[model samples]
Every structure is written in C-alpha cells, then in structure tokens.
Target: MDCIANLASEKAVVIFSKSLCCMSHAITRLFQEQGVSPMVHELDQHPRGKEIEMALKRLGCTPAVPAVFIGGKFLGTANSVMTAHINGSLNKMLKDAGALWL
Candidate 1:
C-alpha cells in the first residue's frame, strides 16, 4: 500500500497499467491527445507488480490494471475515467492536477 501511494504521488497524473491492456492503452492515448503527459507505471513489468495489484484490488479496482490517480488522489478504473471524460470533468481534473496547461 505504501508503495502504491508513493508511486501514485510521483506525478500530477499517474496511471497504474499493464503494457498490453487495451483499456490502459486507450486511457493513455486520451490523456496524450489532450496534451497531458501522465506518468504510466506498467505493473506487469514491475518487480512488485503483484503486490501493487493486490493493493489496488483492496482499493476497489475491479480489474486492478488501469488504476488511475490524479494529484495524488485515486481516480479509479477505466469506466470512471471514461465517465469523467463524458461528463467533461476529466479536463478539469487534468488542469487541476497540473497535467494540462490548456
């Protein structure tokens, strides 16, 4: 849990992801398209990946991968991100987190 927290706080926007997950890819692309350079941690390639995944599971991430954090706060899974985007709050969050200047 401490590891997860530390990693999440390392940047304005952090995405805990698996390199090949399509959802993770899409979410990353979305942020990039918006000109937000999020810090992406590929869990499958991390040494303590499983431990982090379990921690994310405890935090209620159903699929574990693609867990997101903004401004050191947990923002949840792919659905949550997509919903925030659809509701027009995603850009606000990005700006607030300093991941977007526009």
Candidate 2:
C-alpha cells in the first residue's frame, strides 16, 4: 500500500511493529544493539493500525507485526531477520541500506 511504502521509504530501516509484541521488541533491540536507529511504527498505536495490519496480511505477512523494510524494500518477518543476523548478513544489509556506517 502507498501508506506503508511512504512510511518505509522515510527511513533506511523501518519496522512495522506492535508495542506489545515480543518479537517486535526483539527486532528493535537487535537493530539498536547493532547501532542502527531504525524508524519503528507501532501499529497497535497508530490510528490506521487495523488497516495497515490488513495490508501487511495481504502482502503475505502472517503475523503482520514486526514486518521489516530496508531501503524501502520489504524484508521478511522475525524468522528471516534472525536468520540474516545469524548468518552475519544483517550488518551488510544495514550498511547497504545506509542504516549503518560500519
């Protein structure tokens, strides 16, 4: 959706999350620990949260929270993110997306 795209493109790293979701928190913490300040949207607190969640679902996000976008592109959910981190490709992706200087 245009709304999601606009928000995602506003920053090098964007995370659509729910404030109470543990996975969302984990993802946020991971980015912070990596020294990347990502733009995070707490969907549960957003006015159009329900609509946005639906949009994410339509886009193939099952849980619909902790959806990540990097360089204005949709990356996968928590599992994929964790995989990338484990494989050490997360830092490279962050650097490529301008979310990290190192």
Candidate 3:
C-alpha cells in the first residue's frame, strides 16, 4: 500500500493492472487516446501481486486490476475512469496531474 502510494506520488498517472484483464487494456487505451502516458504496473507479474490486490481492495478499488491514480490520488474503478472521460472531466484531471501538456 505504501509502495503504491509512493508510486502514485512519483508518476503523473499509474494504472495498477493484470496483464490479461480487458479492463486494464481499456484503461490504458483511454489515457493514450487522451494523449497521456500512463505508467502500468501489471500486478500479476509482480512478486507481491496478491498483496497488492488486497491493498487495493482496502483502498476501495474493486476487481483489483486497472485501479487508477492521478496526481497522487485514487481515481476509482474502471467505470469511474470511463465516466470521467465521458463527462469531459478526465482531461482536466490529466491536465491537473501534469500528465497532459496540451
């Protein structure tokens, strides 16, 4: 949990994911389409994958993978991610995170 928090603070955007998850791919593509380079941490590949997933769960992220962080803040689940984009607030969030230079 502390590691994830540190990562969130270090990167403009980070997606905690599992390699085979479609939602993780969707989350990655969403940020790419918006022109933001998001750092992806594939938990399944990490040594502490299960631990990370549990930590994320405690953080209120469901289904684990694709948990997003922007500007050191949790951005909720994949649906919230899509919703933010649809609402046009995602761009602003990215901008505020310094992930979007445009």
Q: Which of the two, 1 or 3, has more TM-score?
A: 1
Order candidates by lDDT, high to low: 1, 2, 3
Clashing pairs in 1: none
Which tens-of-lDDT digit does each residue in 1-102 have in candidate 2?
999999999999999999999999999999999998999999989999999999999999989989999899998789889999999998898999999997
List where candidate 3 sits over 4 angstroms from the true fold: none
| Model 1, C-alpha of 10: deviation from truth (Å) | 0.7
Top lDDT hit: 1
Per-residue lDDT tens digits for candidate 3, residues 1-102, read 898798668789999999999999989998988888898889999898888899999998878878999999999889989999999999899999899988
Give candidate 2's TM-score.
0.97
- lDDT value for candidate 3? 0.89
lDDT of 1 by residue, 1-102 (tens): 999899999999999999999999999999889888899999999999999999999999999979999999999999999999999999899889888888
Candidate 1's C-alpha runs over 4 A off are: none
Q: TM-score for all predictions?
A: 0.97, 0.97, 0.95
Give the winner by lDDT: 2 or 3: 2
Give residue 53's lDDT in candidate 3 (0 to 100): 91
